[model samples]
Target: MAATELKAQARTGVGKGAARALRREGLIPAVIYGDKKPPLPVSISYNEALKRIYAGGFLSHVITLDVDGEKHKVIPRDYQLDPVKDKPLHVDFLRVGAGARINVQVAVHFVGEDKSPGIKRGGVLNIVHHTLELSCPADAIPEQVTVDLAGLDIGDPIHLDAVQLPTGVQLHGHEIDPTVATIVAPSGMRAEEAEAGAAESAAPAGETKE
Candidate 1:
């Protein structure tokens, strides 16, 4: 994915009061931390950050941190939001280079409908896992990982190997058991069992139902 261009400025204050004050001014308080440079406190315009993030794959966007007119490469490592208000509260910017590898949570996206023979025959497709943890270069990170469930059967288990990752992406869940999807028989299938039982039922030699 292409990197998103964003603008940010260095901050001179710290603490809740300072952060609140920045918010009141319609700005988001953030920090930039990297290997060689000291962590720098910065602030970005609230409206600008919201717009970029809402567009999708905002975390992978390389930001230009204009700290007193000095630009630094950074990516959003973490962010906090107000639960009720759903507003951006604070953001953490980690200094990174184009070659650096970072571990991030990539969203899970469904590619095809659960067309398993069992599901078509009144079975249900249940998904137990959502996002997956991956290690990839920040530049090549994907917004989501697509999971294909087209050929699965009722008893078929979609495991981690079933998922297709981007060129350089690697899943951390590979070592552990991977269960992406499961097919379950629907409630109506129970009626079929009952009917089969009745068909096999027989009356005693001399005793018959009216």
Candidate 2:
């Protein structure tokens, strides 16, 4: 996909009063920092900022910032929103340099649910992590991690090692391999299994429980 370009203007003021003044003018206060460079104070159109936030993967996708004719490669590090109106208040963008690998949380998508034998048998798909933190090339970040559920059986777990990730992307900050999801038996099936186990435990000398 083509990169998104956002236009911004260099701002000269600081403090709450100045920020409020910008907000009244339909602009959002923002700062671009990182990559060993001094922070650049800027303001963006409030409507444009809000629209990007409403769009999914705003934080994950790499974007270009056109600040007063100077272009910058950046990714949204964080942002603040108004509690009452849910409007964008401020934004923090991190500068992305060449060959830089940044950590980001990518959404998870499970596919082939109907093809999974366990799911067909009424087994529940229990998700452990809805998003996985990954470190990858700043320009090649993945939109989401897709997990294939075909042929998975009850009691089977979907582990991070089993899922295929996009090139240049790898799990970040994890010391041990993690389970993304698990297939669990249905309530009725679980009850039946428990009852059968109890009966087997009660039997002695190979004799069946009455």
Candidate 3:
């Protein structure tokens, strides 16, 4: 993935009042740490940061921070937003080394739903895991994991082992490979409705006692 270029300026003050002032001026306070380097306080344009965040996958995507003409390769570690206004408040970045290994949560994408045999049989697709944490080299981070449901049957399930990981990427730690998605029969409520309708239609007509 291409690096998203962001321009930021060094910040001097550190306090709630200072942060509020920066927000009032359409700026977002942030910090960059990791790689055994001292944490550097900085501020970035709120509009620019919001744009990146809205572009999706901002946390997993590599970003280039330009501070006073110096470029820093970093990834978004955390961020905050105004609870009421839903505006960007602050962001945290982690400086990555050339060969650094990092743990990140990658999103899962399901495909071939229309071609799934289970779906054609009126089975519901139940997702067990929506994301998986993976450990990989900083430069080799995967955008997302794909799970195909082309030939899955009603009782078939997709597990973690079925996902294909990119080179240099692996599941983080000894986490058990759990079910990612599965096909199940339709809801019991629908079955009950059908049974009730059949019983009412088969009932004998009431006779008039005149």
Candidate 4:
């Protein structure tokens, strides 16, 4: 994880009104806490926070928060966004150590053609799952995990166990999860084919039907 450098200022105010006033001034109220340190209240600029989180991995990205003259190595653990205005409300920073084991949701990327034999024979590909939970050392966590679907064919559904992960990373999904991505025959197309076959069979033996 790399650290994003942003300036922070110590906050002496508390309560909703104070926070609102801070936001009105283009600042985001935040707090930093960890097992070894007491919670420290701070604030940052709205533009900097948005730039850090807009990429979607800010929670796992380590940042060197420059609060006044002291620098803290922290990660964005949580934050709330304004429903209508889409602005940052409150932010929570967590101090992280290099060797710490952390649980996080990683994006899953499916690559290649639908591998099922059914798909090769014209079955539609249906993906029923997306993100997967994983546990790994904070430093070894990957931005995303890729699943190879080039070999998947119709009637063949990839399972959690089949997914590959980086060394020391473990998936939290169970074998019982119905994470189905199948190569299924299109219902309308199948129905039309069946009807055409019936019409051909019903015509006179020597008669040709277009």
Give the alpha-carbon lDDT of every model.
0.77, 0.93, 0.89, 0.79
Question: Mind giving the per-residue lDDT tens digits that candidate 2 earns over 95-161?
Answer: 9999999999899999999899999999999999998999988888888899999999999999999
The Cα error of candidate 3 at residue 85, in Å, is: 1.9
Better of 1 and 2 by lDDT: 2
Off by over 4 Å in 4: 114-122, 173-180, 190-210
> On residues 16-78, what C-alpha lDDT tens digit does candidate 1 reach at each position?
999999999999898888867788888898997787667766665566667777777777888
TM-score of each: 0.79, 0.91, 0.87, 0.79
**Model 3 global lDDT (CA atoms, 0 to 1):** 0.89
Query: For candidate 4, lDDT tens digit of each residue in 9-51?
Result: 9999999998999989999899999858789999999988887
- Which stretch of 10 consecutive residues in model 2 shows the poorest summed lDDT? 168-177
Candidate 3 per-residue lDDT, tens place, 1-210, comes to 567789999999999999999988999999999999999999999999899888878888888999878899999999998899888999999999888988898899999999999889888989987888888888888889999999998889898898888888888856678888899878874688789999999999999899
Error of 2 at 4 (Å): 0.5
